[model samples]
Target: MSKIVYFFCFFFCFGIAQAQDDLLKELDSDSIAKSQITAAAFKGLQICTMQSTKLASKGEWYFLVAHRFGDLTEGFDNFFGFDNALTKIGGLYGVTNWLTVGLSRHTLNKNYELTAKYKLANQEEQGFPVTIVGYNTMDINTKLSTDEFPELKGTDRMAFSTQLLISRKITTGFSMEIVPIYIHKNLYEPLSEEVDNFLLAGGGRYKISKRISINAEYALRLNANDSSFYHNPATIGLDIETGGHIFQLVFSNSQAMNDVSYFTNANGISDGKGIYFGFNLYRVF
Candidate 1:
């Protein structure tokens, strides 16, 4: 009788210990899953003209406004570009946490654009090293007219851009991104630009404080002609977070905001000559 009692007690304690260990293992697995993803690499949806890995939350709506003033090289002659400002206005909707859709109109070429951005992968704290996002846009140039080219077709006025955005958060306050871009235009000046172009773009951001940061970006055309009038696009900017909106003050060599134009046709040099000053504002609802 005594031996049986001791055996029963031992079995009961063993079962309890086994259940506790399993519970702890389950909790650890949950913790690892929750902490596997790294923090956001950027605050704004864009790192300069290039798109960042950031995405709006599900069901969120964003309103965007941007202005690229005339060349600052014109100085007072153009009131530092205020007199010839080009404006872009757009809206973005987060269809899901991993997908966003946007539409916008630009005054630069009387262009309208439709865009889709989707998340492919996310940076993991100890697993994957980078986050990947895909971006694609279709541009419609309303400024094109039969008056300029009588043979122009509807397809001739359209352009497209596709990009792969890869980024990593290096530290608590520093982040970097690289993008491989392809642009297609149905009609272009053969003497200067290509109907299909490829470019590699890089950009980075450094946070100085919680509300402000410094950012820079540059793009290189992989197959640009030496005789072409276009230069590579480069930009530097400051980002300010105001309560509920993000404001960016930018100085870029390219004045055209459309992706098809921005990456392929820079009007100025990065050395600061002919630079255009601009600002981008975003509000979320």
Candidate 2:
């Protein structure tokens, strides 16, 4: 009888211990699963002038406004280039958690653009160490005149851009990204013989506070047909987040906002001589 009671007690304790161990293992698995879904590698939809690997939550709406003044060295006679500023107004909508669509109009070249972004992979999720996203944009030049070239068709005014955005969050406060971009223009400038352009863009962000960050970006053309007329675009900026809005203040050597125009048509270098002051405001709803 004594042996039977001892055996029963031992079995009961063993069962209890086994159950507790199983419960702990389940909880640990849940913790790791949650950790795999990373958040906020970048604060806003853009790192500076290029798109980031962030997409809006489902059903969210975003309003965007951007401006670029003329060359800051234009002197006080032009009010520091504020008198010749160009503006871009646009809106973005989240179709899903991983997809966004946008449309915008820019004063430069009277350009109209439609854009789409899709998230492909996320960092620290399912053994992935980096995030990847795909971007596509179509631009139309409304300012082109048929009188200049009677043979020009409507399609001649169209341009397209495609980019692959890859990024990593190295630390809690620092992040970086690389973009491989291809731009196609139906109408090339008279000086250039190529209709296609390839560029490599890089950007980085460092958080100074919860609400502010220092940002910079540069786009380098891989194949330049004319070096004198086209230069790589570089921008440095500050990102300020307040409530549901993001405000960006920057200095850049490019005047056009769209990829095709800025990447191919930029006439300024990163040097101070042709840099222009610019700002972007984003509001979320």
RMSD of each: 15.6, 15.9
Instruction: Name the candidate that leads on lDDT.
Output: 1
Cα error, residue 236 of model 2, in Å, equals 0.4
Q: Could you give candidate 2's per-residue lDDT for residues 153-237 as a string of tens digits?
A: 9999999988878888888899999887778889987575357777778999999998999999998777667634678888899
Reference-based lDDT, residue 25, model 2: 64
Candidate 2's TM-score reads 0.86
lDDT of 1: 0.86
Global lDDT scores for all candidate models = 0.86, 0.82
User: Which residue ranges in model 1 land beyond 4 Å of their true spot?
Assistant: 1-35, 270-272
Clashes in each model (backbone N, CA, C under 3 Å)? Answer: 1, 0
In candidate 2, stretches whose alpha carbon ends up further than 4 angstroms from where it belongs are 1-35, 270-272
lDDT by residue for model 1 over 133-227, one digit each (tens)?
87899999999999989998999989999887889999989999988777889989899998778777899999999999999999988778667
Cα displacement (angstroms), candidate 2, residue 5, comes to 79
Best by TM-score: 1
